[model samples]
Target: MIIDFHSHIFPPPLIAARDKYLSDPCFRLLYSSHKARLAAADDLISEMDASGVNKAVIQNIGWASHDLCVRTNDYLLEAAARFPARLIPFIAVQPLAGTKALGEIERCAAAGARGVGELRPDVQGFGLGDDRVIKPFVETVAGNNLVLLLHADEPAGYAYPGKGAVTPGVLYPFIAANPDLKLALAHWGGGLPFYALMPEVGAALKNTWFDSAATPYLYRPEVYERAADLVGENRILFGSDWPLLGQRRCLDELKALNLSTQTLNAILGGNAAALLGLE
Candidate 1:
């Protein structure tokens, strides 16, 4: 029951016309170079097979263009439909799009989207803490019973592409405010779990989860044990951020950790299965 809780897949046309999408600042930051891998559903399925993954949550980049967001959301839904047992789809929306964004979320939820995000508020032209602007978007996600995954990177880390400003400091208030949203912060919640050592911060994170997306590049292997210690094992999800990193490689790194089989199993899939309500 190995479940990848975070991964991205683009439509073939989008990958083909990568240059066209580069006009969007976020997309440009990530994929401006031809070396940056852009995967389609087929690529994901193949990687899953090779990595022994039973299920994967296919996500979309937080596109600045509402059109790209809609188109990619459709592709994720279609991909999940095509591989019902193997893929779970999470829709993308530019929350800054106002009612249109809410409309996109409702349409996708109706079409079977289980969640919303890898949202990059920094690139999407908003702040998660901007309640006046983001409250409705967060409300819509919660109302529809969907998990929200936000792109988070540690503020103190070495600079990298796509690492716009969302950090633990920025994410805490939002997490505190939206206590009911099933929020999964990508990239180890930009190291937010570490702050959970603080009693108040831990209390505020009652409904939050963290994913190890791109962790191999960001932290040492001790991160898993330390994060679990601070936030508990159930709060972490296995996410390779595949295409950016390999599933097999991520799995290998996780397995190499000196963790109990029970804990390892929980991180590998049990937690995500429960989070997603998967049988």
Candidate 2:
């Protein structure tokens, strides 16, 4: 029961009219290049079959515009409905939209959205630590029993596309403030799990999970072992960041690390299953 915790899919129409979406800075930064791949739900299903992934969470990139977020959320919900067994939709929302964003989340939760995520707070013009700005949104997500996945990046790393300033410093306060939220920080929690070595940080992150979305591009393979040692195997999730990274390629790389079968299995699926309440 292997699950890729982070992946993205677009509607065919959105992919066809990619130019129109480029007006959003985050979209423009990631998709302006012709080489950057834009995959649809069919593409994800095909790749999952080839990679032996049983299920995947469909992520939406941060869109500053509420209209863009809603448009993409509709597509995510539709795609998940079309392939209910294989896809889990994590709808997107521009938290700055206030009540409207909460309404969209309620609507999607009723329609079958399992989570809300891949949120890029920096690009979305909100600080994760800004309780006044995001508390309502956070409350709404929690009320719906939806996991919140935030985009996190290493604060000191070389710049890359979509690498905004949602680093550990910014993420820690939010985690402390909302200790009860089921939070999954994408991209290895921007290296936040490493901080779990500190007693206080570790305590605050009891409910947090980290997804290895594009780890091959970021760290050495030893990261899997090191992160597990610091935060335990249950806190790590296997996320290929599909389209940006291949499912098979990432799996092969992790497999090469020669981790024990138990540890490997936990990261690959066990942890995510428990987190998502999958049977």
Candidate 3:
């Protein structure tokens, strides 16, 4: 089964919120209206069918205002309810909101949210490894057996558009500290696989995983092969970061990589299925 693990879908409420926020001069410069044009559940299924994708794990945008997280999550849950076979919902919670954020996580999980994140600390205005606030939230997700997907930032030298604020240095500490938590770092773990050979930093983060969201724009097409060689095929998964990067483009990028059938299959779907317990 082909599963794209990192994609975004904005419902109507989120669309309105996005419009309101984007109207402001400060916000308008950073994001484009293209983000607001996400496919709904039915549209997503149609696109997935055309692309030969069996399922997609969807997330909400990080730029959403405080109340919008819950509203968008509710919309995502409702969409998943209508098409559970095609969509896997991941709830977005803003850690800076403290207890309120935890409550949202609980509520969303209770309503069947399979995971929490695509958490953008830069856009969300928090540190990726802010232990005191995020620890409790992490524990809740770990306890519930849900995956934690963080939108990791690339190193300073490698920073590109849509990189957000999740630097590799910041993520190293976070992953090191939260050894037991299952983490899928979006955007090829912020170019982390390239640094995995470092004994001091690499050994402490065995549970870290990577999703190839926005990789086509950031790295060469051969990156998947190099990443699999460095991080092991089991730790990598396919992610389109769709609507921003189209599903067809991402799949074509993956196909262009000269990898073995086993590695290709793992990156395409096997790794995500195993990580999300879909097996």
**Candidate 2 local lDDT, 1-279, one digit each (tens):** 799999999989989989988889889988998789999999999999999999999999889998888989999999999999999999889988889899999999999998999888888888876777688898899999999999998988789888888899999988999999999999999999989989999999999999999999999989999999999999999999999999999999888997999999999999998988888
Give the 10-residue window scoring lowest on summed lDDT in candidate 3. 23-32
TM-score of each: 0.98, 0.98, 0.91
TM-score ranking from best candidate downward: 1, 2, 3
Model 3 agreement with the true structure over 15-104: per-residue lDDT tens digits: 555656674331353455554354566667777888999999988766445586887788899989988888899988878788888888
Report each candidate's C-alpha RMSD, comma-separated, in the order given.
0.8, 0.9, 2.4
Which tens-of-lDDT digit does each residue in 126-200 have in candidate 1? Answer: 987778779999889999999999999888969988887899899998888888999999999998998998999
Q: After superposition, how far is residue 210 of candidate 2 from its true place, in Å?
A: 0.3
Per-candidate count of clashing residue pairs (backbone under 3 Å): 0, 0, 1
Candidate 1 backbone collisions, by pair:
none
Q: Model-by-model lDDT, in order?
A: 0.92, 0.92, 0.80
